[model samples]
Target: MKRLLNAIRDQFELTHNEAKSALLFFVIILVNLLLYYSYSAYTVNEQSEILIEDYGKTEIPESEERKSNWVDYGSSYKKSAKKVERFSFDPNVATNEQFERLGFPKYLAKTIINYRSKGGKFKYKEDLLKIYSMKPELYADIENLVSLPSKLDKKTPDFDEHRVIAEEKPAFAPKKTFTISKFDINTADTTQLMQIKGIGKVFASRIIKYRDILGGFHSIDQVGETYGLDPTVLPELKKYAVLNTKVKKIRINDLENFRHPYLRYNQVKVIVAYRKQHGNFRNTEDLKQIKILDEATISKIEPYLEF
Candidate 1:
């Protein structure tokens, strides 16, 4: 140690007092570091004990404790469950309480009551199957206990001897025939369309609404697309209806071009993007440039395109 100090003194020419002062300063710093480490350890241990004591003494309110108990026990508690007792029932006349006792859900019981109150009748046991909420398994369980009339009274024919004789006399006479006037489907309003034999207000309105959506019908066959129009009535409608082929044309560049029933949003996006990239479409055939547009779709939408 002394030789090392001599080498240090020779290298830097330090006085003995200066070397001793530097050594003393380093020792003081080392002691301070050790003291700080010990103090920190003691503080951490004291804080941990206080935290554990506070946690052990924490108290929940009574209401919160009760709520927690309910959350844990409510679903499994037998007293909270609905008691269903099977019994013979007539859905048409059974009271709501009776229906409930017979195992019908509360909403279903109310529905059945409302249906009866509105003059709806369960003419047969099978009619209960029409309840929107009645599951097949539940129906199967109660099917045997439901009592309903074998046949409704309205379905029974009323016998009249005098009317029967008059009908038999008229059976030999000729049947009358009527001619229906043909009308233009494009120009015919709901009132005029309802003049057709089987066309009612609902059917006429549907036909007009669909025609407006299409801009106008190009063919009488397109009338078949009207919602709720029966297939059997299509022939009758075709015989009396004529298409003028005058339809409102949609501009290809219009922002609302996607409103057309035949053009989907994606197809419209592709068409608009292509028009911007390659310039406006020159003709209907230019639509084929979009790979997703099949020949069938192009043909269907061609009549409605202006450019």
Candidate 2:
């Protein structure tokens, strides 16, 4: 302490009180340093801003697209369904293999069937987004694989309201005889259903045996129940179908009895679903299994029962 005091008083030429002032200045500098460090630490402890947007509407630059190169990094590249000549993607009709071909996980394929069975249809691209916990990236992957068209009601579209109208032949037309030469709706195979105009391979097959449990359609409107037939096509289907077409429901005891080879899958599914619910097909309503069922279908299948 004496050495410091002598150095301060001699070398610096400071008064006794001046040295004390110098000491006070050093202490203030130390306190300022500490306060600075503490304030910096506190301020740094809370520093952030939240962000909440992924890839929605960002302008992904045309120049970036132009500069993109074709690098072969994947084992194979998948094409969009729209790019392909023919790709099957009937959610109700796609097999597990077909589902995988469309790039959906196999585990979720059955869930998709359940979705369809519950009256869901892949009507729009957005519908796939509604799947449970479906990933956005996955939707981006398969967005192109989905195909949907507007639909009309089979009841209104395919019903032949003009059947009687056409029957009212004039005196000259009274001599004009009409002969039937088309496949019967009640017994036609998938191939046979195709003879009808506007019915494609997919729609034809679905119409014949979609709910094979119900036998044939009791009403022409039942045609609308076929896959891909939404309310939009009702006017079209109505032109070609007759509401009084002979059709029947499966017997309660013989839920397993569809003799048509084309209807095998539908028949078996109906039996299984029937047994699952009521153990027997006492009524057409027993067919709520295999997929979705509705009052409209039940009414259609109710007319031609033997049991």
Candidate 3:
């Protein structure tokens, strides 16, 4: 090939050494061009075949996809942290949508938003407990979801037509003024005691402590044994205080769906309690053995219950 190139160079009127050197350069250039053409053809073929191979590889379904930072396997990484820091809500300015976003029940969200629209602000944190149709315990579960305005957002909320409807709703019963003696000392739970006109957690706890220390409260005055038990509270306390020695201890089992006061016909909580205290029931009739439960309550709940 070199000799042929040398002769061709000579025929073109080039010197032997010059023709040889020129032929060598031409050979190098030709080899480079061949390589470039090969690479270009390979690249084109690769691109065309990419679709046939599913864009170079098969895609994973979203469920099987590698998740982004916020998502993993299924849920958001931030959401997985059970103890969520609650969002702040300006009650006066909060919308029903905002309340729902905070996980308030639909009725509660509407009531809270409507309450604020009527020139109302939660003067105290506990004032939130007074919303109609809201249970004290349910309110507590959602309480952490409440977020007040920052110092910059501290302006009071204006009252609107929504407020009128909320005001009309009587969330609380007429505060039954009662002495501790009027409430069956044994029967009152924290909830029933709180319903008494003037009672709060501190006073209620004191009454229970007093009952425990004395083995049982024989009289309403014995409640005075509690530290910080205001002597003047007695005038109000006497109305609610009922001294009954026959106290029943109701144990809470699975907390998911027990102790709901509205569920007066709950056979499940009673059955669960019975099973815990006595043992697996020998028969269905044994359900009536619970003093607080009756045949009607059992009949209403029998379908959902088990041993």
| TM-scores of all candidate predictions against the true structure | 0.41, 0.25, 0.22
Please write out the lDDT profile of model 2 over residues 237-304, one tens digit for every residue: 55554544455544546544444322355655665556766665555545554354455544444465
Superposition-based RMSD of candidate 1 using all C-alpha atoms, in angstroms: 35.4
Instruction: Report the Cα lDDT for residue 200, model 2.
Output: 60
lDDT score of model 3? 0.59
Q: RMSD to native for every prediction?
A: 35.4, 43.4, 42.6
lDDT of 1 by residue, 167-262 (tens): 444455576676667778899988777766556777788888888988998878788787656555677777788866598888886554456778
lDDT of 1 at 82: 53
TM-score ranking, best first: 1, 2, 3
**Lowest lDDT 10-residue stretch of candidate 1:** 72-81
Q: What is the lDDT of residue 142 in candidate 3?
A: 54
Q: How far off is residue 127 in model 2, in Å?
A: 72
* Model 2 alpha-carbon miss at residue 289, Å: 21
Misplaced by over 4 Å in model 1 are 1-179, 254-256
lDDT per model vs. reference: 0.74, 0.56, 0.59
Q: Pick by TM-score: which candidate is best?
A: 1
